[model samples]
Target chain A: MLTLYSFGPGANSLKPLLALYEKGLEFTPRFVDPTRFEHHEDWFKKINPRGQVPALDHDGHIITESTVICEYLEDAFPEAPRLRPVDPVNIAEMRVWTKWVDEYFCWCVSTIGWERMIGPMARALSDEEFEAKVARIPVPEQRTKWRTARAGFPKDVLAEEMRKIGVSVNRLEMRLAESPWLAGDEFTLADVCNFAIANGMQNGFSDIVNREATPHLVAWIEKINDRPACKTMFAHSKSEFADRGRKVTA
Target chain B: MLTLYSFGPGANSLKPLLALYEKGLEFTPRFVDPTRFEHHEDWFKKINPRGQVPALDHDGHIITESTVICEYLEDAFPEAPRLRPVDPVNIAEMRVWTKWVDEYFCWCVSTIGWERMIGPMARALSDEEFEAKVARIPVPEQRTKWRTARAGFPKDVLAEEMRKIGVSVNRLEMRLAESPWLAGDEFTLADVCNFAIANGMQNGFSDIVNREATPHLVAWIEKINDRPACKTMFAHSKSEFADRGRKVTA
Candidate 1:
């Protein structure tokens, strides 16, 4: 039995959620609400000291980090459809894409998520409530980001974030021109990981990666969006703030 | 049969260099000197579009990203000693360590490397030459960082980076208290990846993780340092800038 602890439709949570969906694996979603600071609660920290979501409890063998957790599901549960490629070279190629999400694209998307979506939600909270919530964030960097976003992201950082997003989108467009999938010819974990972040853009910043600017990325997003797993996963993902992001995109 | 393009031992390059040593695999080390901005040369861009180091070209197949490169070495050259555990669960555990290097620690260490070490090296360049060198850097974000570091990292950013480093170091101390190695009992790729960053701290910030503060971590670093593979890797790692880092630590 596998249980996945995750937060929302926008960030790292969606990465493993999509992986579980693509592989058609059965997992109980123990949704941790970030808006309530449930992840940083003492109870949750016992599960993961880092207090990050996308932690997996596989028969009490705990695993954290969405990247590791996604691959763990692929490795541990072989009966499910293989989301990672078998060839080592292809696997290496696939990993680069996941690295892109974890290291770069996630930050760009998250900057926008905080500024446009979550920031508004946080601003709506009373000063005492917001300061209390920010203080509870386990990671200092995140606390600074959330607090800053609530105040409003400076134009420079937001501008740089948008530029980075453009670079990510442009690179994706160029890559899709070659291989049908991010890893190669077949759908794999790379697609699942990339789709998690790309899906957010479709609703929240449609203009950044629409047909005109990034035709290949837009087409790729559309094709992946239509997948049964994508539909199923999105229908189930939860977040008070991200739900609004979904509505705005819708 | 293999070619590895890299620069600066302290950053991403040390990761694969250590892997190659641990596995006893010999690849052509096409050292791209960062001090002269050789990595940003047009020829180097053909090897890696991002103009980052630690790109491995196996025969004709090119793979970039230090995380992928390190694992690819294990997968392709199976005759060598295995740095990754065979058990899937252990493998998952190992990946968390590498993810820490890639997503968190790399930034912390690199922030210090820029502000404390390489920043001085970059500033030593003449004005026209420095401007020319900066112009060649393909990635805009990196160019900004390089320029910012040359001017000396703003106090606030460096303060935040140092705080992040403390967080990463504290987490390592806690994990080492539990297990002998980052990936449980075995010396795995996790060690190679982390050592790349941690090795730098021994000289640059010795007080932060010495025996008194984190006995386990200090002992762990010393043991890993004494490994024949690490010795051999450091002996051969080439970069004008990193050569200085090595001397400082030595």
Candidate 2:
């Protein structure tokens, strides 16, 4: 059986989960908690030295990197469905769009969601609790370095990142308006990647998504949210979020 | 015949040039001067709206993005030697290596070659010459934005980028030490991408690569440099570089 190592509520992990569910593939899911840094443990590092999820272990062959994993699944399970057109020109278009989704869209998710929203949410602590959390870092030098880097980020930087998010969302809305999915009429890997990150963005930061500003994008999100596979992944993820006592928009 | 719109001395442009030359595909080459922002011209934008060079017009179809262009050439000229393997695992491995070469190795090249080297070269200009260059931008606001961005980068940023180059060079050295190429024993698109960028990096920054620091990587570069197709691309690019008063290091 295939095993997927992932953490709940992570955009990176959601891509593979969505792909697997869409294909109706059966797999065992093992969750990693980023809050606990369990991914950095020696056992997990053996699977992925990068210490990032989602990592997939198919039989004995281990594959890491979200884009790489997605490609692998497409190849391994050709009977399931095609995520890209077979023709060279269409494949090229698919690849470029997939790359764009990963690079630009993923960057927006990291900058706006993780850095701006998630980081602040994680750090919402009393002064004593904050000091204790800082003290708990295994390496003192690393703690100091992290603090310095965090302190260097100006408020304007976050604002600029949020603006970039708006620009990307607008671009995505325009793209969705023309085609049902990110890559024309088909629900390709591009849509899977976009769906995962876009879902997180809309849910984590509703302020960024509104009918007035991004009506088309908001509607597209609803369309994807209604899919059976998406609903299943969202329900499972939501249960995990509830278990952790964190509010989940998905 | 295929037509390639390109500017010499760009790492991205070299990918398709090598692919075309290696596959013995006939193509007409048009040089666009980045210094004048000729790629951003309305005429050029119709071919590639991103306003970046190294675009290919194959028959009537237009293709942009170097990686996609190379893959397109491979598919179109399948009778020519296959640049990518057909097997799933091999294809996945090739994709992984290609992505790494594009993302990681290209980062080193952009940081070490363009951002670091090109700025000092650009800054040596007289005030009138610099102003004239800035005025060539079609959009006034874009010109202001470009000027401000260029003025903001410090020398240390380039130095830090060079350090990253050294780290990547070391990793490549280890990878090449085990196999004849970047991916494995076979010479695929991975080798093509690495050769193009490594050639440029060696030309601009010698300290990052040497017999001692990257013995295997140096050997790999020497082997690829000896290829007739690579030699042709290198020689053809010379006049373009000489026109810029910069020595050709392809």
Candidate 3:
């Protein structure tokens, strides 16, 4: 039995959801809403000591980290549809993109994301509610992020975030201009990992990621949007907030 | 033919070097000295657009990122000694530790490391010389990091870095207490990746990572130090500076 615990169709959660749909795998979706502090609950903590979402439980085995879980799905079920490149060289190319997303791109987008959406929700909470929620978070850095979001990200920090985002967009544009996907011809997990964040750009970061500024990225985003699996993942969104920064092209 | 372009026994460079030694693979080592700005030169940029070290050229295909390079080595050379777990679940467990080190542990350590090492090197440069070197760096965030290091990291930032390091040490201690290595019984790539950084702690952050405070971690370090491959990698160190933060057990 396979079970995936995730939040709404946000950045990290979108990864495995889309991959699972693409791979045509059957798994249970256990939604752990972060806005409601469900992820920090003791039950969820038992599942993942880190208390983070997008964790996959495969036959009594627990795998955390969205990218790692997706890779696990590919590794354990070789009979399933392939999302990774066959050649080790191509796979290395794919991993470089995914690693870049994990280390750099995701953080830049998530920082801006928390500031815009999560910041407001956190600020709306009562002082006691906010403190209680912050106290329950397992990671110290995450706790600091929550407290900072509630208080407001520093002006310089926010500027640096946007700057990083701009760089990511430009690099994506440059890469997509050369090939159909981030890792050459194939639509591998590199695309799946990056599209989660790139999908948010048309609506959230149109100032820097629009057609005029980043036509290749915009085109790539539309291509991924056309996939049937992408639609299925979007349909799984729980609320309008889940589709907060996503714009569907007709 | 495998050729690895890397620096000395520093954080990222330590990973591929140790993995190559452990796997018993022969490869050409193209040492790129960052201190001399060789990594940022035009010749090196052709190999890796990011102008970062620890890039592997497998035949004609080039792979960047230290962790990704190590994984590439595993995937391409199944005949070599295994550094990854055979079971998918164990692989996932191994990955969680490696990913955490890549995303969190390494940055905290590198931040402090840069302030102590790179800051003085950068500060010692002539104004024109520093500006010329900074202009050659491909990544914007890296440029900002170099500038900040030269200017000196903020006191608040350095304190936060130390706090993160303390958390990392405690987590390592807790995990080591349970198993012989990071990912249970077998010494996987997870050990190789973290050991690159953990090996530095004895001489560098001795205040927080000593045997008195973290006996399990200390024992694990000593165990890894006893490995023939570990000794081989350390022997390849270019300068006394390469052994700056490493303490050899008597």
Measured by lDDT, the strongest candidate is 3
How many residue-pair clashes does candidate 3 contain?
Answer: 0
Q: List, residue by residue over A71-173, the lDDT tens digit for candidate 3.
A: 9988999999999999999998999899889999999898988888788889999999999998998987789889899899999999999988988898899
Please give the DockQ score of every candidate, comma-separated. Answer: 0.78, 0.56, 0.89
Docking class of 2: medium
Measured against the true structure, the TM-scores of the candidates, in listed sequence, are 0.92, 0.86, 0.95
RMSD to truth, every model: 2.4, 4.1, 2.5
Output the worst ten-in-a-row residue range by lDDT, candidate 3 chain B.
B241-250
What is the C-alpha lDDT profile of model 1 across B87-114, one tens digit per residue? 7889998998899788888897788777
Predicted candidate 3 versus true structure: per-residue lDDT over B2-37, tens digit per residue: 888888667888899889999999988788876688
Q: How well does candidate 1 match the true structure, expressed as C-alpha RMSD? A: 2.4
Q: In every candidate, what fraction of the native interface contacts is reproduced?
A: 0.84, 0.54, 0.97
Q: Write the per-residue lDDT of candidate 2 for residues A143-173, one digit (tens) a residue.
A: 5533543444457866776776776887788
Residue runs of model 3 more than 4 Å from their true location after superposition = A236-240, A243-250, B240-250
Task: Give residue A137's lDDT in candidate 2 (0 to 100).
Answer: 52
How high is the CA lDDT of each candidate model?
Answer: 0.84, 0.71, 0.87
Encode model 2's per-residue lDDT on B1-250: one tens digit a residue.
6998887635778788888888888888888876656776778878887677789998778888888898888777889977777766666667777777766667656654444435555577777877766665564445654564456556786676666677678778888988887666678888887776777445556666877767888888899889898788878763353344245243
Kindly indicate the candidate among 1 and 3 with the higher DockQ: 3
Q: List the residue pairs that clash in candidate 3.
A: none
